[model samples]
Target: MESSAQLVIFAGLAIGLIYGAVGLLSGFCLMSSMRGWLAEGDGRLVRTYALAVAVAIAASQILAGGGTVDLGKSIYLQPTFSAPVLFLGGLLFGYGMVLSNGCGSRALVLLGRGNLRSFVVVIVLGIAAQMTLKGLIAPARIALVQVSQATANSNSLPSLLATLGLGETVSRTLAAAAIVVALMLFAFAHAGFRRSPGQIAAGIIVGLLVAGGWFVTGYLGADDFNPVPVTSLTFIAPIADALQYAMLSTGLTPNFGIATVAGVFAGSLTTALASGRFKLEGYSSPRHMLRSGSGAALMGIGGVMAFGCSIGQGLTGLSTLALASFVAVAGILLGTAAGLRGALRVQPLAVA
Candidate 1:
């Protein structure tokens, strides 16, 4: 590996460590937030999520605007995308999140605390993701994406605004400001959220980490001879890749995602041990295990189909202001809503 790629891998480790620590401390998770707000009538965590989104948008756009990172290089900004596939995938992922009681990132954090249930989730999810990406499911996913993909001259919000005769800088500025302001207002409007400084800091830190990932790949990893992929903090494909690397260490070179995955587990374990929170846990019943396994499979497939998961599309992809990211996120929110309310809602498991 080139020196730059090695540096990027190490950077990924650092970023993942910070994320794991912060996530454990603050319990920053989209599924938890949705369940809290929709099922339990608590909105403070959702507000914290909103703040994170706002900060991510602000920081990412600023980096793009300053030419530090080319947001266009990211996969989310592809000129042609399948809205139907993305939406459907998001729905699957969101519903699966509820079934598993968390998303991929959350499962990783929980596993660090010695949650055996999360170990099942992580393994199943990784296998499923790999299947979707390269195994039996890959052909179907590729065909679906190909059949439904739509091409556009402007694939992103800012670019669309520019096509409407706005200057590039002005369009980016206006779109980012509008969205950021709206999210910030929603986040800060709640008195409960405002009173929780820890939640506030978690949001800010997580958002900055997203931007940091972009910088690591786009700037520090830039090379003429050996260029690293331009990506941020995404979990779906990375988890699958991590699993593959673990089994085939001699043949495969370690990348940012693999290093990050390892870092997250290590970081979370350290934090858990330090805080006396480490405990071995498993499913309450066979039925519970089955449900979690199913959810993990769905998350793997859906995340691959949609091109991301909650943290992937919701925070990292959206930070680039990609139009497809919006559609995917809307689908995720709707799916979460479906799981949290209405006839399709998943009932809480009975306590034994």
Candidate 2:
């Protein structure tokens, strides 16, 4: 492998380890946030998530400002985005997340803790994602994307602001800073959240890791001869790629995404073992497995259609202030609400 590829993989591994450790330590799942906020009236976890988003946006924009990374060249910043696909994909992903009781990242964390059920979810999700990305459904997906694209404008917050007569740099700074500061105020306002060290660490560490991912792929991984795609800690395609690489590493070379995926599992497993949190778990019943499998399938398909998962659109994409990111996040929020407390809710099983 090339030395730069090695550096990129190492960077990915470091980011993944930090993310896995923090996620495991803090119970950082969006499913928990929805459940906590709606069912249990708990705001701590939700607030922590908000803090993570805010921090990610601030740090990532700083990197962009310093010329460390060109955030505009990212896939998230595409000029034309298919609104229909993004909404549908986010809805499916969010609902599936609730059904499986975790997102892709959470599944990796759970699998690391010896959860066999998560193993099942991971496989199903990966295959489903791979199929959506480049299988039988690709034609239909392409057709829909081509038809429903909202094209013409810049499709970014700063660009839109510039259209309104603001300087590009000034607009980006104001847009990013205002959002981050508002989120920080809301996140820190809660006395309970302020007192929890674990929650604080998770929010800060995960946020930085998102920005760190941008740094790894956009800066460290940049190559003139063998250019790597500029991206960050997105799980959908990467999960599928990791699975494929596991079976075909002889020919296929390791990249940041696959390395990050592997690193998350390893880091989570190490933490689980060291902390004695590892435990064997499985499906509650055939019906439970059915629900989880179905959800996993939906997540794989939807994540591809929408071009991102919860973390992808919710935190990482949003950090760039992309309009499509907000739209996707709204769809995810709506879908999560449906699964958690709306008409489409999957009833929870009884706790033994």
Candidate 3:
């Protein structure tokens, strides 16, 4: 059992590294995609992100259907519903990502590019995330969770389909196929989108990474004595956890999400150094720095409330087909739109 556990840890780390590298290379960022669609009228990046969501949903469902994993065990599919918190959290996180000019994952990648501004944003985000997760704001979050709890089934669409009288296998298969087909059609329909290999590959690989995370924790990390939390990619809390781990390594064992977050910074650094993309860039003015820091702080608090950041809820949570995730995603979209329009127009910082 000890050896098996060790193997599982190693596998999880490997998956994290691959995810980091792929994410860095492909520039997979939900905030950037939304901003591009809203500000520039370029929908390719958004389409790629949508494609990844669809793929993640199909693949994760297939894993659950095969009995290799149980999607219900994940946090996103918690039986207790908190609609208000999820929506509000999503809005905060989405708006913050716009102000910061990137989401958590994007910050990691930018950190590698030697962007000192992103480093500040990431550090603030991590610290704030920790505060919301288990620090000063924890009690408030706990109270909210308690107040808004609801009893409901926490299964994927396919599982719901089974509940509705469809055969389990057929329902799972059909649901997965339908989503995959729809996503593919959307991604490939446009000539320009099809030609952008970077965007397309990012969608596919990131989708696979979400499934890989599930396999790591849900399958490999399942131990009788010390089972790991069934989770996948999410930047907010993990960044906080990573900070905590650095300070209290003796008290906490390394988890998959923290390890993955660390891997992203490392991977991006490696890629940047090798490609000569590394540079020391910081905020041009104090006001700009303040804006970035405030954005990061909002993301941390919001991510905690929403239960995820872009990759967390957008890809990982949605892959499970939880109704809450859908709500959160919708909130994120709405928030991003608001940020990109009207008085919320914040100047975007140049990529470092």
Q: Give one digit per residue, the lDDT tens place, for model 2 in 117-181.
A: 99989999999999888988888889999899978487888888999899988999999988999
Candidate 1: worst-modelled 10 consecutive residues by lDDT: 343-352
Q: What is the model-wide C-alpha lDDT for candidate 1?
A: 0.93
Number of colliding residue pairs in model 3: 0
Which residue ranges in model 1 land beyond 4 Å of their true spot? Answer: none
Candidates in descending TM-score order: 1, 2, 3
Return the lDDT, model 3, position 348.
60
Q: What is the RMSD, in Å, between candidate 2 and the native fold over all Cα?
A: 1.1
In order, the Cα lDDT scores of the candidates are 0.93, 0.89, 0.82
Q: What is the lDDT of residue 193 in candidate 3?
A: 85
Q: Is candidate 2 or candidate 3 better by TM-score?
A: 2
lDDT of 1 by residue, 1-352 (tens): 7999999999999999988988898899999999999888889889888999999999999999999999899999998999999999999999999899999999999999999999999999999999999999999999999899989888989999999899999999999999999999999999999999999999999999999999999999999899999998889999999999989999999998888888888889999999999999988888899999998999999999889999999999999999999999988888878888999888878866
lDDT of 2 at 20: 80
